[model samples]
Target: MLSLRVPLAVALLALGRARVVAQTTVKTVDLGYATYQTDASIVDGVTSFLGIRFAAPPTGDQRFRAPQPPATIYGIQNATVQPDECMQSAVGNATTPFRLSKRTAFVQNEDCLFINVHVPADLDLTSNASLPVIAWIHGGGYAGGSNGQNPAQTLVSNSNNTVISVQMQYRLGPFGFLAGETVAKDGVLNAGLLDQQFALQWVQDHISKFGGDPSQVTIYGESAGAGSVLQHIVAHGGNTQPPLFRAAMMDSPFLPFQYEYNDPMNEVIFANLSQMVGCPISNASLDCLRSVNASELNQMGQVIALDNLFGVFTFVPVVDGDLIVERPTVTLRKNQTNSDVTLIMTNSHEGDVFVDAAALVATNSTLAEYVANLFPRMNDSSIQQAVALYSNLTDVSAPTVPEQAAFVMGDSIFVCPAFYTLDAFPADSNWKGEFAIPPGTHGSELAYLFADAVPGLTFNNSAFISSFQSGFFSTAIALNPNTHGADDLKPDWPTFKQTGKTMLFNETTTGEPEVMTIPTSDALLERCAFWLSLSDVNAQ
Candidate 1:
């Protein structure tokens, strides 16, 4: 027998520009257990349903466990207000430039596993509108960030009401990424990744209720979010039956040192975390840690993460023997990826923000020292090879040792992952791009995509925004970037497989948009190949 819990006196008010006065009645969707009322007043043509709970609160005994579906709700829950972001942590005050402080300024809590949906206002819910869906996963090095950072209103409006955009919030910091033999045995390893997987499954089950086509789902993310996309691609050795997503878009996918579940470093981190929380490291540590307060555990995780040398996060995804069978490099090399179509891009200077400028200038750290610090497991032979490759770099972009260090960091972590992803997928089914706008620092291209939503971004080039959004929307709607809208002035983007060509997004000296395709530099490819070869030693 089927039991449905319907809300009583459901009244959804759609507001006009003022948002204070009711303009019309809004629609509601019944998700078997609960009914949600959406807000159609935030954007002009987009209706947003925010803070829809997908999983039960992961607090107390549920901490460190895989996400479970939400409990039954009895009434019409108001989903207009954004939920509290997942708890966040930073290394002192150095993260201001990356906007971590601003993004995480809101209230945070353990009951933070929520999903937001934005759809075209006029889409018919009764009819089979079946709009293509874009599910976004936020990035904060897998430690910090909220789904509210990048709003999907613009993307939905730009799609001409042809697409639906969904954003998901998952666990972060120690709550989401804690891993060791004890955690593996008692709690789930990669709980954060499992949260993402569960959210995608929620979309599969409920997106159609809002007129989305489950078959045309595209998973899009940037930075750590993009890395999460890659994790999903290689999940279960790319053998996930009925793949979660059909297409994927990765912007500057971050590939950090993916240590094994029971690596010495992870064991040390777990021990440190348990000790900090007053829990002895033993068979009962998992339960003991779970008994500790959420705030205390979060603070301890931040302390442990900051204890490491600058430029890296302590808690990140690990190579669990099950979900992540092996290093992503190994999976990608063997062509074991699940997604069918992929669009990948990277900034020209991905590592600038990650390198410690003060330490580089004061200590004059050698390129070898920088490399070793970032990848301690790397062997002497590989370190020498890396130093030989980057030390004498004469390129004007990376002339100094610090610049060279930044280049090594960028290539190994961001650029090479994009190249490897392109190589792993079918050439004809994948496309590549480079965001070379002035400075081209990591997350710079984000402004072009979410200019109105992201704070402190000064990008206002109308032509570039249209071109960039067109390319992204076309891929989501038609699975091809070249099929841009008529207003888009960008040229036809060629596939990476066809000519090894990359669509470079830049501006002319006079600040006009200069978007064109060029052959991917063989020199860069050579450097990435060298890095990929040392994946084993680097633990990537």
Candidate 2:
């Protein structure tokens, strides 16, 4: 009988024990909401807290509005199983990447505003552990993605229980970013961003219960998530009233084109979505939109997103005066970003996923056609010049039109904009940015950070590269992202302002880590300069 007793935690869970013992329960100060333990106790001493509510379910009349604090629940509730991801359309077919396909099944319903917290089991919340926190936002082009898709278990383990991590799901696609005058007057613009903001508020109020320091919170994101972090830095004219997080880290922070409030194109897309769902245009248009089924709204959103070829998203954040005051580029130029933020921004073959994954080009004609469609302002002469630049830079070993196009796309959409934005920071501000090597495609770094790297996959790298990349994050959490941590951690990674230096994270083999210093090169800075010199053209 003694030998038959399983692990104590498992036995208790199997026996349906629900008691709120001090060792087994985590409590939130929100009206005494208690969360029960899980059997996910790994050998590394990490504890997983899955599916904790950060906001009230955005359903019924609450739909399309700013998030509200979650309703208080009494007694110990089970937080063992992952919660439903916010509603999203099924993605990628047989040809789609496995990384994306694995995430589709977890998406469930509208009431998906949930947060997952990962803490070391030995952490004593009652003591002054005051662990640094990393609030991660996942990347999915703002149209699709869920917190359930990326677990923080590996990240916590990799950090050696040195830090606490949090990831939360906000509204996606139409539900998160359907901006029009009709919706704006009735509610807020950029509800998805607001969802993130509210989650941070929740963290500020409750992270201490898990041994995390609210004041030491650092917001980090990749791709669209990185874009969201940049937005927070520039939100409300960069005020960050009440102070959400102290520092930020953005990986591949892509700023897609956004229209200045109520651009006719924005209204056109909103009207199209409304008609698709039989939401008649009227004074009560927002109400009509609310009445439609969640699945119907998501289905229509996917259709519009699929129809587009260029980077034009069917649903994305816009320059509403309230939440986002102006174009991010414009804000950056004016030095309107929050100065309080010490930032680390980076990109990995930023355009590889955008161009290579799409199978976008096969010949010169196709490449030219793609460029013209993406940047309509460029005439035949300008397009020809751009083509010449990319053609000359194509890798000799793997020379292909598509691969060449990927290089071009990387510069245009990812690399160039970073330099342009960094220029916006004051010369004294502590900011650093870099480019990763060994074919750092979009969303590639995530594979290493999450320990989800798959062999034979395009983004997979040497183990040394993975461990080295992971250090940037752990160091950031232990110290500040701007320091990037440790004088001897890697060589000396300098800040962007100091000597205009950017450290490159590269490795020669699976066992050898190489740290090299290189200036920020957009590959085609001259070309980017030319494009930037142009006045706003109706690229549409």
Candidate 3:
């Protein structure tokens, strides 16, 4: 017979096991077709489920086509490792910022349509734990960047376990946005945008399993990602029934020249890409491109993009007549948008990263020359009008040619599009802000939000981080930045229509976070109005 002492010892070991479960236990979620398991250890009270496939790999014949639903998997899939990034075009040079180029080391592959989800470790999956959700789309000029670039563990933990975060990957560069009459006839245009929409639909279907409320999703993004938010806002002529998202937050939306699908320049870009990859331009060009090796094709895309103007992206979203409908400016002006609320932010200097100082100085380019290069479709008269509008500005931030170029590029591509979005929504439903930390250039605010994720950056201003996160997470959680329980350090923010005021997030001269509100600048609005008037000419 077994001794009483041995039985008592076994019982004691079982009683102490619960204390160590959080550190060693792996979490799993079932979604009918597949079961994904999260990381074993919980960090900062957040558990991450990474690299879950949302769509099937776009390869072979599927290349350049819209993303299709992922095939069913028989066994539990490991979601602990970050997914490989979609093939990216090399867009960095000596003058490129370190923040943008740091991702050169990320592994890339064609099978990269995965999504990552982060939720509180203590969330009860069996119970009715319908927490808020924030879906992030990263910015890489539509050419580079991965879903892993912005980790949401800190964001989920900072929300006091009240919100879940999701990030997705989409095809980039030529594979996603290749356009022309040939592509329109054979493949989908703006395939990357379709990938994003497919991921959002996936979120609607699967987020509830992760303890998130599908109806309370907030879409947030930066640069091209933010521009994507604008695209979705105007998607389907703003008639997305049973809407995918209720709110949106755009950080430095990059609205470059969106050419029509069959425009001469786009056709030329397609022909050049095909020729570079040995496909040549013909009826079978699409099939030839599909047959080429992935690396060879991606390298050709980079070559073609770098061969073009210095600071322009070659394969951005175009007016596809279906998903895109028309220029975003036209759609927004008609008050046709899907999102119910908007929070838009711009950096103090958005153009610095895009413009090369040596190129501006070496060419001795005039404003008209720079503007012409940026928008090749604009006629000579319109170029001169743009030059005239910006040439003699008393409020020019700096007098140097580089500064002038930055101002012009920033306004046309980044800043002014923000104003268009702001003016599109009802004042009560919209809010705007400027991230003005000294020399507040493009992507600088990202460090403040994801300090640990961004490399080679150190932010010690706890107060500012607290204030900024409160406003952003508050908006995602409650649809208002000034919601109760948000950081008290932040001032009473006002809607854009209520006061026409822009909240400025800055640091005092002594290096402490300072939050204040100021009326929208009349001078800036004047310049934006001039740019908007030329939308038809610039293909905006």
Q: What's the lDDT for candidate 1?
A: 0.81
Q: Point out where model 3 deviates above 4 Å.
A: 1-24, 40-43, 92-104, 455-459, 484-487
Per-candidate TM equals: 0.93, 0.84, 0.92
What lDDT score belongs to each candidate, Candidate 1 first? 0.81, 0.66, 0.81
TM-score, cand. 2: 0.84
Give the per-residue lDDT of model 3 (tens digit) for 1-540. Answer: 011222100111111121121332466899888998864332467877767899988999999898998889898776655667888974534233332232346567888898988888787777878998999998888998886566665678777778999998899999998999999998999999999999999999999999999999999999999999999999998888778999999999999889899999889889888888888697544888899999889888887766656567878999999999999999999988898889988998998877887767876877787777777677888788777767766654567767777888898999999989988888788889998886789988887777554542444677777777777888888888888454466676789877889988887888777888988888789989989998988888
- Model 3 sits at a Cα RMSD from the real structure of 7.4
- Candidate achieving higher lDDT, 1 or 2: 1
How many pairs in model 3 have backbone atoms within 3 A of each other, for residues 3 or more apart or on separate chains, i.e. clashes? 0
User: What tens digits encode model 2's per-residue C-alpha lDDT throughout 1-540?
Assistant: 011322224311111122221234343323255554454442246666666788898988888899998776666555554567676643223222322222334436789888878888777656767887889897777876776555555566677787788898888888888878888887667989999999999889888878888988888887778778878878887776788887667777766667764888778878888888898865345888888899888887776666565444557778888778877766666776663445555655666656533545323346676677667566888778777776677322326566666666666656666666666666654555554556666765565666542232333444544435554564456443333334433555455666677766665666345566676555555656755554254220
- Answer with 2 or 3, whichever has the higher TM-score: 3
Give lDDT: candidate 1, residue 12: 27
Q: Where does the lowest 10-residue lDDT sum fall in candidate 2?
A: 12-21
RMSD per prediction, one decimal?
4.4, 6.0, 7.4
lDDT for residue 28 in candidate 1, whole number 0-100: 82
The digit string of per-residue lDDT tens for model 1 on 1-540 reads 002322332232221011231222476888997898864435667777767899998888899999998999997876666667788865433322332333334677888999988877776677867889999988888888876677666678766777899999889988999989999988988999999999999999999999998999999999999999999999999888777888999999989889899999899999999998899898544789888888888888887776666668778899999889999989998987888889998998998888877667778677888888778877888889888888766443576778898888899999999999888888788999898887898999887887565543555778788887777788888889988767777789898987899998888888788889988877788889998887887778
